[model samples]
Target: MRGRFARAARLAALLVLAGTVQAAPVHASEVAHPFTVLGTPDRRDVVTWGASADRTGDAVADRSYRLVVHTSVGGGDLRIRLSNAFGDRPVTFDSVYAGLRRDGAELVHGSNRPLTFSGARSVVVPAGGVALSDPLPGRLPAATDLVISIHTPDAAGPATGHWMAMQTSYATQGDHTAQESAGAWTETTGSWTYLDAVSVRPPTGTAAVVALGDSITDGWQSTSDLDRRWPDYLARRLSTAHTRVKGVANEGISGNKVLADGAGQSALNRLRRDVLSQPGVRTVFLFEGVNDIKAHTGVTAQDLIAGYREIAQRVHAAGKCVVASTVAPFKGWSEWDPAGEAVRQEVNTYLRGSGDFDAVTDFDHILRSPYDPERMLPFFDGGDHIHPNDKGMQAMADAVDLSRLDCAGRR
Candidate 1:
């Protein structure tokens, strides 16, 4: 009987040990968080809107700007990038906010949200540097007006901005970035200040296209506040199309050149910041060279071709495709001459025949008249004979093959 009792006690002790093992908690270090396992790897940020930054020469202290921008793709977690790229000293932004526009200088109710930087309310950007804001929560709709208000407490030196925004924005004094009404935003401006680019995270596999060109791509002749630029129209088309490349960024600068810097930076010099730095860009739409050709700076067809090839090589090295556009005819412009026209023709010929570019869009054919191949079609000309009107802009956007913009796996 004694032996039986001892065996039963031993069995009970073994049962208790088994229960303890089954109920053991996992060590915090041994198990991975669910978010770490399933969140970051598939998510990517794409540029929804961007403008090339240059010296504005309008620096001031204790000023606020209510800049309006248009988005190309809708997604959650919106972020904005401010530039001190042309400044001579560091600039501190004490307050910044993003909201949907209810009207001029007014924000949509309950939509305005504050943007933080590394969990701080302020960020200091050094000269020739850029600061990207921490992502704001919630989804931003595509093709909507996003109002960004910023205040610099000690803004001085050369201000960095896009001088020709073509969109009407507002400004005022003191810290009014937290205001959602237009009551305090009394002053008006035509350019976007400080803010250079905006981005958002879309679904995996989504991508973007950057249009690198001159005033035409910059919406020079298009109606202001109408979003009538060729790139804007292209963004609208991409939104409903089956292609995954929906994001569009216009990197065009007025009077910009492909070979030299005057308006902003040359295509070669600014390519890294304006084009390559944009996230999830699958293609670089090359539609420049008219300024270089017409300037009569002794740029030959060979020289222009070399520039194009260099741009193509650099873009390819970055694992992106290049879609070259033939320089459109501009005969009526004051700079038009037989010498420049001849160079333009030769360059177009090379752009058409050369396999250096991944694809080609014949903008010359689209905008030039069949009656006289050297001049723009009167219907599309924007009075200047160089820049195109809204109709012409839409036509240019329509000419792009949607499939070519989707350079997935074609790198």
Candidate 2:
């Protein structure tokens, strides 16, 4: 009986130990969180940082910007991308927070959480450098917008930005603990800090939309933080339609040409990096070649068409649906050459007739003046005769037939 009691006691101790082991929580530290780079090559390569320092004592007010990331699939951590790409001096942050914004003002309920990068909550971005956050704690939902708020104490250097893409907005904190409002962004001062890129998971069963073009597709004249660019408008439209398609990857490099190398690299040179190598890419909207006409003084229409054909073949071979877009009217552009205009017309004719594309987007029809067939629609032109304003961008996005896309189809 004594031996049996001892054995039973040992068994009870073993059961208790097992319960303790089972109850041990799995630390977030123990799990490996991975992230993939999104957008086109330019989106991955270019980093824009905002700076504001007036003459005099440099008493700059606190500045902040919101960052929004769309996860591909659910159940993964996130990291924020911050830039000091153009800063002359190190930029320091007082604090930062991550949460969801409601009604464009407040952080929604159950959405506030602290974030860290390299184990430090706050960091200094060196001149011409970037910093990324450590893995965030929460499980980001696929296609959900995760907002990152950053607050800085002093004025950064005068900043340069890609004005076309919309930016996330952020609120400020009063102290180091950064215990300020987590709900809404009412108290925040607007910032122009350049946000180069963001990292996220690939969406499950969904692919990316690659916007391949020039300055127009790059969002040259659009308002900051407004999301009024064609790609931004398209993303909102896609999300609202409940289409599982991921966000548009803006591979549009400013001043990029189809046949020649400029503004990072030519379409042919960067095709693999920009389109083929893009995360979750399945569709490409090619809106380039106008630069080639304008820049290449002696290039003929046939040359441009050949370039388009080559680009289409390469994109298709990479297992992507290529949608060719006609170049918009450039009659009034500062560099308007009658010879270039002639070439443009010839190229447009080929683009319309060329069966090389899996699909085509008629940007000329959307932006061209009804009264003046050669000129861009006056209202859409942002006085540059080249880059379109926010309104023009909206018109372009609206012209796309989303129904034509088999969003579920694999490339």
Candidate 3:
């Protein structure tokens, strides 16, 4: 095995390659069409933090929620999306505020700002729908802890939210969104409710990437609230890189797939809404398919390849690059078998050879064990051999060619 220091050096070299991609010219219409609220094609509302909502249930009425989401890019104006996509009845959030977090449940004094829907102070989101807040004017710094406080007074029926948030957000009873103090927030929840995405209006040229993957991208075994997921690390890298792609939204669900609907909608089905609909998105980082292969659903490499080709083609049609990744090795997991391993090898070969994608990152190369070609390196394995640990997560982030993420190449 190579020394850890040597490995780090080589990994850094790989990232240098990833970050060396040339500036791909973006059309004014590629990103401008989605921002009807601003009434111009110049808004840069890049998604900073996002969670894939799953399994709707009833929501408590007359409750206040202060959800904490981290931002990837900085800008003067901010907008948030509240979803009731899984509900069967109307859900109303009366008092909603956006503020900066100052430890625990406290908000930075005077940083709490109210968010409105359209011109109204409150709005009712119809069942299976989403509501976006009007742009609020302010300077939102990159990598800051943003708190979105919402009070749904008459909320009932199906509730849409991501269950494995990994981050700790506070909850309280009744309306407390206007308060910036911690006194009213006596409850805590691991999952984020109603709130799905937070975006900011950066410079007109700034761009963002949406990472669509499985639990590994969702930070399952990684430390909670630390923003240690691979995509989080990549965002940190992009913060200082010279590339225009400065924003990143992690859309990973715990058990998502590529060809079929399982955890969240299949990557193909949700691509438009979850990845492309957001403003200022320059690329779609597709890192799914492990769940599909490991699930033993009789999916073939050709089936997975067809899925990849479709994703790349659709992204190209949207005039955005699609950077796919080879699935990491998981032969030590309980689902590992010669048949599954064969499928993984075949798929990885395609990922490395198929010229259909704008770019490809061999996650399998950096994550697999030298001793056992098919298993995850012990250093990166998060016990289950499926998810990577914090160190492994960082390594994966380092493997990307940051430059390829912004290419203007067509499929």
| Cα TM-score per model | 0.89, 0.63, 0.89
lDDT of each: 0.83, 0.58, 0.80
Ranking by lDDT: 1, 3, 2
Q: Write the per-residue lDDT of candidate 1 for residues 178-231, one digit (tens) a residue.
A: 998999999999888999888888888889999998999999999999999999
Weakest ten-residue segment in model 2 by summed lDDT: 12-21
Better of 1 and 2 by lDDT: 1
lDDT of 2 by residue, 112-221 (tens): 56655555556666654455555443445544555566666774564423333345444343332223344444453333244544444433555457777887877778
- lDDT score, residue 135, model 1? 68
lDDT of 3 by residue, 1-411 (tens): 112212221221100011111112233322321211111222457777787766545788998999998989887567788877677788898999888888988987777777766655687877755677777766678898889999999887778888888899999888999898999999999989998888888887888999999999999889999999999999999999989899999889988999888787788766765677667888899899889998998999999999888888878887888899999998878888889889989999999998988899999999999999899999999999989999999999999999999885542
For candidate 1, the lDDT comes to 0.83
Alpha-carbon runs more than 4 Å astray in model 2: 1-196, 199-203, 407-410
Clashing pairs in 3: 18-401, 18-402, 18-403, 19-402, 19-403, 21-403
